[model samples]
Target: MKIKLVAEHIYNQEFSIERALNWILNSMTSEFCMRFFHEWLEIAESGTQQLTTPSWKEIIELKEKSFSKFNFRFETNSKDKQF
Candidate 1:
């Protein structure tokens, strides 16, 4: 799946990043936002970039690391067993 699709899917889960983004980064100064956007755009456009597909363990670790306050459980359904 595409990176955007994966992000959307994850965002649709209980832990919403939209609210977090708005409260954290979006509330920052215009110069900070511009710099952040420019950096993100540059990394996205960089042809040499390569992202490895994350394993379930890595995903869980990331979730735990980023949102330690929330309890997130990941269940593997039949459709997701392949991962």
Candidate 2:
């Protein structure tokens, strides 16, 4: 999935896999990720929405809600690191 690949790419390291997974999980549900990407794409397509990336604080509060909702766990190795 897009989330997994992006997360791994950004957070790749032996000790950072869990952090990567957690961040990916956090981002998928974060308002900053969802609404921002949606609106950003819309704007990119039509040139009508705000031009700047929104603040992370816009979704800071949603972190807890997002975190509590997902419980996925898995093992990863360098073999799974294929781009």
Error of 1 at 35 (Å): 0.4
TM-score of every candidate relative to the true structure: 0.24, 0.29
Native-to-model Cα distance after best TM-score fit, residue 61 in candidate 1, in Å: 20
Clashes of each: 0, 0
Q: Candidate 1: worst 10 consecutive residues by lDDT? A: 67-76
lDDT of 1: 0.44
Identify the runs in model 2 with alpha carbons over 4 angstroms from their true place.
Answer: 1-15, 31-75, 78-83
Q: Write the per-residue lDDT of candidate 2 for residues 1-83, one digit (tens) a residue.
A: 86476646664554466676676666666744566566555545554355554356644543433333444555555665633
Give the CA lDDT, 0 to 100, for residue 65 in model 2. Answer: 36
Clashing residue pairs in candidate 1 are: none
lDDT tens digits by residue: candidate 1, 1-83: 43345445554553344553443343344545465555545444552455545456754554444432322333433444321
